[model samples]
Target: MHLADILALRPVPAAALLMAITRRCPLTCAHCSTSSLLSSEEHPAEWFSGFVETIEPEDRPELIMLTGGEPMLRPRLVSSIASAARSLGTRTMVLTGGFFAPRVPPALDDVAHVSVSLDVFHQREVPRENVFRLVHVLAERGVAVSFHVVGSGPDDPYLTEVIETIRREFRDGVPILVGRVRAAGRARAWATADERVSSDRPRPCTMAAWPTVSADGTIAACCNQDVLDHRPIPGHLRLGHVSSDSWRSIRTRCRTSPLLRAIRTGGPQWASGRSDGGYCGTCRLLGTEQEAPASPAIAYLEQQVIHAQLSAGPAGFMRRYGEARFADLVMLGR
Candidate 1:
């Protein structure tokens, strides 16, 4: 599966599952999204594989994305999940820090796609050369590969330089998904806050569409780092935990929850009827408010919004959620 193929399904509800297999990472990059270290909490391997096992062949997501503070750390778990997902007709993708760069993990054989983290912050810990080498080997093996690049902003010189270099080195064989640094994890203290969504008009939040399995087995409605870190996840955003809930139940709640449906169609600002807090901030507050009553109109609106989003394609998704300047880069190797 190509990166664009995976991204195209991003807006669809329950189209994919994101599992953070482990939180422990060897590289302590300054901008680490999970602030992962060797000591960071990692749950039992069964908590992850058991969930994948629950995904019945007839009712499974189109894709299963494995992520972590570093997913490569648990090679065996990656292989297990990928093999099971594949058997159920679900494609699998892995996003890694490339700490094991220049050496392709054997687990990668079971996956369909691989995205390596390559950015200024990551380069401080993981050499870009080693990451490039790893990706090259994976590409040669017929496993689709892409780079998840991050920078300070669209105008960041680092983005310009690295993007050009990747294109040059790979001869445009590898696609790049460029995004700006967010105020999360280690970067929270310094990284500027992302622009807030205004309540004036409806702004659909695509992030709420997928279910994210966190390190401790808790499954959240969205992939926001804060939502994943909270001890008692907000009622509305909380899907059932992996330890107790089956994939069918989690996906059903994700699609049927009125609040999530509203958020996916009109965003947290409209769903919670407040935008004083930023996008995610307002989403967090929804737990304190009454759940949005379900209605046929809301359901209709969600389908309409998803249709419009599907029309926009992957590059369009990048323009809205990622840096617009490099949005088209996602289509580089398509």
Candidate 2:
């Protein structure tokens, strides 16, 4: 699958699954989101394999995105999940730090897409040329490739230089998804807070649409790092555990939860009817706030919002969720 194809489905509820297969990474980039270390916590392989095995061909997500502190560390698990997901008609994608570059992993054979991380922090551990080489090989093998690049911000000189180089080296064959580093994970200690003005407007939250499987196998309604790492996940955002919940069950909850539906259609500020917290802060506070009851109005609004987002396409989705300055880059290899 192409990068645009995967991102185009990003707004649809339960259309995709983001699974953090492991939290152990060899490269300790300074801005590492998961704060992964060689001894970082990673669950037993069965926790992941067992959950994937439960996916029935008739009721499965269109895509399964495998990620981690470094998902490539578990080559066998990556191959196993890709094979199983593909057999069920579900495309699989992997996001890696490219530590094993210069030698592509045999497991990626079953993967339809691979997105490698490229940035200043990552370059400290994994060479940019090695990542480029890995993408080159993957592209030659007919596997779709893209770059998940991060920089200080849209105007950061590093982003400009690297983007230009990537466009030149790949001749725009490899799409790039550029984003600003957030104050999360290991970067929390030093990364500056986002300065975007918080608004009480009814802004829809697309992040709440997909179910994210955290490192410990706890499934969350959103991909927020705090939700993934914190204990006692807010009642509203916590989905059933992978150890017990099947894909169908999780999808049902994600799609049917009244609060989640409202969040998707009108955002947390609108759903909770309070704007004390920021966008995500308001979402995290939903557990304490009342849950929006299922209603025809909410259902209708959800569909309308989904339709509008679908009309916006991949670059549009990036414009809202990613850095707008470079949103068109997602269309480079389309």
With candidate 2 superimposed using the best TM-score fit, by how many Å does residue 202's alpha carbon deviate from the native?
0.9
Worst lDDT 10-window in candidate 1: 193-202
lDDT of each: 0.92, 0.90
Runs in model 2 deviating more than 4 A are none
Q: Write the per-residue lDDT of candidate 1 for residues 1-334, one digit (tens) a residue.
A: 9899999999999999999999999998999879999999999999899989999987899999999989989999999999999888999999998888899888998899999999988898888899999999999999999999999998999999999999999999799999989889999999998966466478998999999999988999999998898878998989988889999999999999998999999998888777788778888888787789989999999999999999999999999999999998888878
lDDT of 2 at 283: 86
What TM-scores do the predictions have?
0.98, 0.98
Which TM-score value belongs to model 1?
A: 0.98
lDDT of 1: 0.92
- The CA lDDT at 157 in model 2 is 97
